[model samples]
Structure formats: structure tokens, C-alpha cells
Target: MSKYTTIAIFGLIAISAILYTYFFYFKIEERLPIYQPSQINPALVDPSLIAEKDHRISDFNLYNQLGDTVSLSDLEGKILIVDFFFTRCATICPILTSNLKLIHDRLPDGVHILSHSVTPVADSVSVLAAYAEKYHADPSKWWFLTGSKDEVYRLARTSYFACLDEGDGGYQDFIHTENVVLVDPSGRLRGFYDGTKEKEISQLYLDLATLKKELSKIN
Candidate 1:
């Protein structure tokens, strides 16, 4: 090949490689998968919603640690990190709360944590208040919620899909899951992680950053 032709070919190859790298990284980093009921495990999803494609979390009314009524509307423009936990559990719940506290301390103002009490009947507003205090939870950033067991369980099964076993949220029914769910500002399910696992927590952090960038584009 002629000298000029060889140099031109090499330059073109270098430019092509740069473009490929740039596009590939941004494509992967800029988008997170929007989860739906059909995409989640069947056990986690209510049977009626197993085939539904455009599912978003349903509206809920729950009391926070301070006895303030919090509804889904109140969190309309914020990214949510949600989990189900009870204060009296001897297994997994403490670790979940501690790890979540790490996230709470590091997350920006736009992100909020909602720890719903699965045993809300026993976990009154005062009980949740003490639990929040134990974790040094910021009332503004992290909310420990309690309300009707039926409503909370309905959210767990139909909305967030955070657990596997099914129940009616009755007196004998109970749910215990370590799943940590991520919701976008618009209430779409984005991701799920094992709350007790460090690797999963790290992945949650990375996904949160990516979601923040994705939201930036829209706003």
C-alpha cells in the first residue's frame, strides 16, 4: 500500500474505535431497565397482574414515624428506595436497616428511602419513631411507615413486588423479604437488590447514579 493510504486507513480505524467505545459506554450507562409485573418473578406478582406490562406502584396512605400522613402523591418527583421490614425481627431486618442507612447518608436530596413495616399492626407510629431514631434516620430523607396491614401487603404484592410468598395481609399472614426495590421519580420499578448483600448494595449505588443521569436528561 502507498504510505499516505496506509496512514489514512490507520487513522480511520482509530477514529472508529473511539466512536464505538463512546457509544457503547454511554448506551449502557444512560439507561436502566424499567421493571414491570410481567418481568418480575411470578411468585412476587399478584396473579391478576402477571400479564400486565405497564404496571406502576399504586397509591398508598401510610403514617410516618412522626405520625404524618404520607401518600404516594407526596413522593411524586423523587426517586425512591423501598423495602419491607419490621422492628422486632431477629434476622435480616437489622442488617437491611443498617445497610439502608449507609445509602440514606450518601444519597442526594432527590432520593428518599421508604421502609414499610410488614408488621404495621404492632409497629405503631411511636414504635417506628424509635426504630428510626436507632438508625439515626433523617425524618426528611428516610421514612419508617406504618398503616393498615392489608394496604401494606397489597403494596408489597401488587405494586413493589418485593416478596415471594403470597398472603392476604391477615392476622396470620406475614411477609419477610430482603429485597430492596428502586423506583424512579415517576413511580416505575427500575431495579431490585438483595438488601443484606454488599455486592448488591454496591450495584444499587451504581444504578442510582445511572438513574440520576437518566432523569437529568428528562428534566
Candidate 2:
């Protein structure tokens, strides 16, 4: 082949390699899905929101373990790992809390945990505070929240889509599930995992790493 022709071929090959690397990196690093209400099980979603698109976690005002009021705005620009549990539980809650504690301890900056109390009435700030302490949960990185039962239930059903059962958030109603949800900084639901499963937690870590890469690109 002529020298100029050989040089042109090499240039094209180099360009092809660079393009392959760029696309491969981006393919693996693409952001997780922004889960919509329509994408979730209808039973777990409020009927009013079943057809809604672009759904985000609704605003909330709950007291944390430290008795500080925490709202959705307070968590803006944060990647949130969220779950629902009550202070007093004998079965899966303890296991879920333990796993979440592991996540909380290892979370990087701009990531936080929001553990909402299913039984907000029984899980007052004092109760949540003790629970938080039992787990050595850092107040800055992990927040055990308790507030109006109605609001918490609403968020569980409509926003996070964390459980399978239906409830009105009434005095007689109750919800219990092991689902852990991940929310991106833009307030979109990105993932759901079984909090009691080790395999699921491992997957969560992998997804979180991917999400961090996406966030890094945006920032």
C-alpha cells in the first residue's frame, strides 16, 4: 500500500478505537432508570397516580432522631437510600435495619439514608432516637424519621412504591415490607432492592457506583 494510504488507514483505526472506548464507557456508566408510578406495581401505587408519569417523591415534614424537622427539600441534591420500619419489630425489621446500617457506614459524600417509621405514632422522636443509637447510626448520614402516619403512608404508596399491600394510613392500617429504594439527586426513584437479601445489597452497591459515575458527569 502507498505510504499515504497506510497512514490514512491507521488514522481511521485509531479513531475507531477511541470511539469504541468512549461509547463502551458511557454504556456501562449510563444512569439508572428514573422509575415512574406507571412502571411500578399498580397495587403499590395510589390509584390517582397509577397513570401518572414523571412522578417524584412528595414533600414530607418529619422529625428526625435528633428532633430536627426534615423535609424533602433538606435532602435536595442528595442521593438517598430509603426504607420503612418501626422501632419495635421482631422479624425482618431488625435485619433490614442492620443491612441499612452497613450501607450508611460505607456511604460516600452526598449520599444519605432515610429510614421512615411506618408506625409514626409509636415511633416518636425519642423512640427513633433510641433506635438510631442502637444501630450507631450517624445523625448526619442516617436519619430515623417519625411524623404523621398518614403522610408517611402516602409517601410509601405513592412515591417510593416500597410495599405490596394497600393501606389508608388509618389508625387500624399497617404496612410492613423489606423493600429498600434508591433515589437520585434529582428526586427520581432509581432502584428497589430487598433489604433483607445480601445479594440484593451487593447489587445495590454496584448500581450506586454506576449512579455516582452518572452524577459525577452531571456535576
Candidate 3:
């Protein structure tokens, strides 16, 4: 074949390869699916269910600061503001926890705050207890949880519907956002906030108060 013919054949192959890869291998979700409890079951399921449920975070058994299991079911009747962080984190974790403390302080009795450690292996009950003390975490009110690497990642992504990727560091690694998840008394997700921002978290507090007003009628 002539040189021009060979060049033309190469260009076509490159285009075909690009098309194949685009269609088969590269699927990225721009945003997580929003899950409302009302959409739990249906005959013809909505297409968003898988995405939503996959990103939804729930209580898998995790050890709290005192080494007790704080299962998702255990939080069924109370309002919970959950987030992810690790004690050893030199970046965003401290800011998130300090902001959470403000929320914990303002929330009326019966409301709870939970922070799950993304560094699961390094944050066993004893390790987390030391970290919690550093934050002055009140075990009766705020719970700093630590568990297996798999369980923590599951909670961060599936339970809390926040980004905490293991790919950033392998099984012992986690990638995350500064998110504070607000779950209503009925286990329904109510709101989310940027844990690093005081204004946003303060707004979360106001929203929590509004939720408190509504939940009180049932109490």
C-alpha cells in the first residue's frame, strides 16, 4: 500500500478505538442520586434507584468511642448528623469536628451527632478514644466511630451519601468531602452541609431546629 493509504488506515483505527472505549469503559456519575424513603419499592423501579441506593450510607455495625456498636437501626428514632473524618488527619478533619461540636452543643437533648473515621484500620476503639478525648468528644452526646476499612467506606459512601473513595489510597486509604449529613428521626435524609464552613454549618443548625419543631409534635 502507498504511504497515504497506510496513514488513512491508521486514522480510521484510532477513531474506532476511541469510539469503542467511550461507549464501553468510561461511565462517570456527575452527581450522586437522591434517595427519598418513599421510593423504596415499586413494580417498575425508577432508573435512579441503583445509583441512589449505592451512594446511600446506613448504619452498619461500627464501634463508637466507648467500643459499643452504633448500628444504623440504633439511630432509628433520633435525629443524627453524621460525617466522616479521622483523628490523624492533618487537613479537614479538625475543622469538621469543631463545627460539629457547635451543632452538638446547640441541638436539644435526644438529638445526636456521629462522626465516622475514614481511617478505619488505624482508628480502632482505643485509638478513637484517644482521638475523641483530643476533641473533647462527649460520648453521651457525640460519638466518634471506628470500624473495619470496608465498613467505614460503605458508611461514608452508601450510608451518608458522601464521597469517600478507597481508590485514593487502596484499602487503607480514603477520599472524602467536608459533609455533615442530617438524617431525620425516621431515618430519612433531610439535609447536608459543608462541614468546613461556619456559615453553612450554622444554617444547618437552624435547619435542625426546624426539624426539631416538627419532630416534637410526634414526641
Candidate 4:
């Protein structure tokens, strides 16, 4: 072969290797969908907030299992995962907690998990403390929150859009859902998953990693 022809063939081979590495080993990242208030179930959002494009998790105050107060302010500028459960739950709650534990174990810095007690009356600070211990949860990363039943339920339905059940946080109000909600660093709802399912929880982990990569770009 001619010298020039050999050089051209070598150049094409080098370009092919670079493209393969860029597309496979160094995969291009993607951003998770930012869920708008109107896109969520109508029952969970107020008519006014529905049309608002920048709806976020509203401010809230609840004490963690360790008796430390946790609020929206605490989670500001952090990626957060939230789920609703009661300590006494006998069915899917355990599975949800287990899956959450896996996610927490694999989490990177600046990520937090909040498990709010749906039965705040029964799941007091002391009860939550024991539950946290049972799960071997890292208090710094995972928080089991408990507060007035009304406050917890209101935040679940209105702010988190975490449950399909409707309630005014009244005496008879109760919520039960298998969903685990994801909130971005900006406090916008980003994704939802079935906490009780292993496959869905796996997807949550991947989405969380994607979110972290997206945030890293700005920092």
C-alpha cells in the first residue's frame, strides 16, 4: 500500500477507538424529568399551585427520631428521597424500608432520606428512635420523622404529593402508599418509585446518580 493510504487508514482506526470509548465506557449522562405541580395527581395539589410551574416542597417542621428538628430549610440545596410509613405497619412498609436502606448505603454526599410516620400519634419520637435503631440507619443520612398527625398528613398530601389518599389532616385522616418520592436539590419533585419493588428502587439509585452528575456540572 502507498504511504499516504496507510496513514489515512491508521487515522480512521484512531477515530473509531475514541468514539467507542466516549459512547460506551464514558457514557453520556442524562437529566431526570422535573415534575410540575400540574403533572401530579390533582387531588394532592391545590388549584392555585397546580398552574404554578415552580412548585416545590413547602416548608415543614418535624422532629427526627433523635429528637432533632428537621425542616424544609434543613434539606435546602440537597437531593432528598421521602416516603410515608408507620412503625407498626405489617405489610409493604418493611420492604420499603429495606429498599431504602440499600439506597442510603449507596448514596453519595449531599443526599438525604426522610421517612415520615403516617401515624404520628403512635410513632412518637421514642418509637421512631427504636425503629431507626432496628434498621441500623445512619442518623446523619436517614431520618425517621414524627410530628403532629395533622402536619405529617398535610405535608404528605399537599407538599410531597406522596400518597393518593385524600385527607385534611383531620382526626380521621390516614394515608397509605407504596410510593417513594424524589426531590431535586432545588426542591422540585423529580421522580417517584414503588419503594416495595426491588427493580424500581434500583432505578431510583440510578436516577439519584444522574441527578448528582447534573448538579456537579454547575459546581
Which one wins on lDDT? 1
lDDT of 3 by residue, 14-62 (tens): 9999999987878542322245533433322233444443333444888
TM-score for each prediction?
Answer: 0.91, 0.88, 0.71, 0.85
Candidate 3: the clashing residue pairs are: 56-158, 56-159, 57-158, 57-159, 57-160, 58-159, 59-72
Give the residue spans of candidate 2 off by over 4 A: 1-28
> Model 3 scores what on Cα lDDT?
0.73
Q: Which digits, one per residue and each the tens of the lDDT, describe model 4 over residues 78-181?
A: 89999999999999899999999999887788999999999998999999999999989998899999998888887787778887646688887888889999
In candidate 1 the C-alpha lDDT for residue 60 amounts to 97
- Decreasing TM-score order of the candidates: 1, 2, 4, 3
Question: How big is the positional error of residue 65 in model 4, measured in Å on the Cα after superposition?
Answer: 0.7
Question: Which model is ahead, 1 or 3, in terms of lDDT?
Answer: 1
The TM-score obtained by model 1 is: 0.91
Residue range 51-131, candidate 1, lDDT tens digits: 777888899999999999999999889999999999999999999999998898898769999999999988999999999
Name the better of 2 and 3 by lDDT.
2
Please write out the lDDT profile of model 2 over residues 1-219, one tens digit for every residue. Answer: 999999999999999999998897755556688888888877787778777778778899989999998898998899999999998888999999998877887888889999999999889899898999999999999999998999989888878999864768999889899999999988889999999998898888888899998989888
Lowest summed lDDT across 10 adjacent residues in model 1 is found at 22-31
